[model samples]
Target: MSVPPAPALPVVGDGLLDRLLPSVATSLGVAGLARPGDRVLEPARRAVVVLVDGLGAELLARRGGHAPYLRGLAAAPGSRSVACGFPSTTATSMATFGTGRLAGEHGLVGYEAYDPATGRAFNELSWEDGPAPRAWQPHPTVFEAASAAGVEAVRVGPGFFDGSGLTEAALRGGRFVAASSLAQRVDATLAALRTRPRALVYLYWGDLDKVGHVHGCGSWQWGEELEAVDAELRRLAASLPPDCALHVTADHGMVDVAMDRRLDVAHEPDLAAGVAEVSGEPRSVQLHCLPGAVDDVLAAWRGRLGEDAVVVTRDEAVSAGWFGPVEDRVRPRIGEVVATMTGELAVGDSRRHRPELLALVGLHGSVTLDEVAVPWLCAPARRA
Candidate 1:
């Protein structure tokens, strides 16, 4: 089957993250949240959100044979077969996922964005040496909202993320349970549900994303991982409380760029001219131009990269609704000039990024359908 045609998605409206949490909030009759599309998620006593990182809808559709349970969900009318908006990356998507708001509102702009306050580039995912989590992302997450409403919220993931900057910034609140394996995580999810009659449970799985990064998403390794994910989720669904609904989703999709398609600025003088720093995705580069050189830097990058990428100023991108209503504070975190790759091209910065990062087979963080489309599948309580 041909991949589904995915036009540019406006996060404010056509995003799964837009209403996911708010819908859950409404299901529990939690007020204060603007509950747009609350009907998407059926009213249930409990809800379990299983976030499979890098599990794009397009990829799943293409390789549906490997995921019988997911394929069935994709074919279901209620399932959002595709999900995502601009700058499709983990950290940015997770911000929207947790807060049920736009990237501009959440302020986790990109994979790596320039911080005007520090005059440095920081990774939004790892959040090492980055801004204070609470101060940086002031928005109250859905977990916090659920907690405030007296709903028991549980987030299950690895041990390292218990107090990580990203977790605190985007997914704070609730009891964080650490489980190393898939079975352990599933057990923890069930345990958390038992603790409360009405609860919001979140499960984060990074194995597929890691496998996709190391091996291309189209590889057999990725297919194997998908099969494993499908089985575990199926098991989890079977084991879910009869009153609880299970929702399966992801942060973003993956696209495998050829080694020859990744262009390093260090190798091209013209591409690096007038540039102060480089951040963002390899496919979508955020160029922080030197003072009084925004035009020149944009021109140089546009000229050098040619048709492989669409280069634009940050102001233009914001105006075009790329970041979805940029706030005064987040305006500077975006690059002076942003270059989002058109196809399988990536702008790599060898000087700033480690060599290991450049060697990744699968890369995302662009608006392309392959990179932007994620799946939001629901296993409703009635079905259980």
Candidate 2:
């Protein structure tokens, strides 16, 4: 079977997080926030960036009827979709968002990456027993830069994230306000904004993404959850103080994989052969091949998976700009063989991942438009 050609690589400096956060920081007058001018957002005295997990631009356009508020925002002037970088998962995108850099510079390559220092698969999200967050990702976050510039930086999210390893790694600085519910988060963000004459507030909402993962992006549950998020966002936007601007975006979009399209490497001898470890999420898998087995592993996966996935060697991936100019130190963490799912197909290792993870209906990580493109919708605060 002939494998189809890979999609065009993400527009690194222009569309990805490398430009987004720096633009935000610059707009807020944060010192040491280095980057080119933003193509999406305008300057504001107060800005609130809301990262709604799993809210893909394509998904939103297709399901706009279910979210009137978001639909209006999408249709607003200057609203456009931006590409999240390769392996467009939360862990990778969050690091990209926080550090205002690509995976190569920030070193959070994937959801789960091979940590050469520990000889284990490091889970970027949980970070349990993994390397120290500061040491693992040393880049100063946009929040930290904003705080250093004397701009009040605030993060409003769930209580558990107040001091999580992921937070420490990506969003270390700032006043962390624990808000368990959407209403609480909105309230906390508003209060934080009021605390300072100029502020940069980061708000996170994960329920829609959770629902999409469990029930599939096509399910009514996903639609219902999106509706709830839309309603809450409507309230939040309406309540923002004058001179505050609200910017909405996401880590990545999701695709619902049919059971027939799901490939279990554990069952496929060719795919499992010479693979020392399987990391990354379902849509994009990182295969750590054994010594002298790189060619064999590559051939096995390409021959077996064919057009259902794009199989590329690490060098090819780097050449293709997947991780965007990988650093020398970060190069080792990438898999020797990387496989990115295409269309509706997903590859997973049931033996390595949790049953719940493998069972997720909606998944994202690949470079497909449905997974990589997210909206950059902005609504400036209305004066009373």
Q: What are the per-residue Cα lDDT tens digits for candidate 2 across 105-170?
A: 788888898889876897888887778889888988888888888889999999888878889988
RMSD of each: 4.3, 2.3
* Model 1, CA-based lDDT: 0.84
lDDT of 2 at 174: 82
Most accurate candidate by TM-score: 2
What C-alpha lDDT do the candidate models reach, one value each?
Answer: 0.84, 0.85
TM-score of candidate 2 on Cα atoms, chains taken together: 0.95
Candidate 1 residue-wise lDDT, 125-149, digit = tens: 8897899988889989889989988
Local distance difference test, candidate 2: 0.85
Question: For candidate 2, which ten residues in a row score worst on lDDT?
Answer: 5-14
Query: Deviation in angstroms for 131 in model 2?
Result: 0.8
**In candidate 2, how many clashes are counted?**
0
**TM-score for each candidate, following the candidate numbering:** 0.95, 0.95
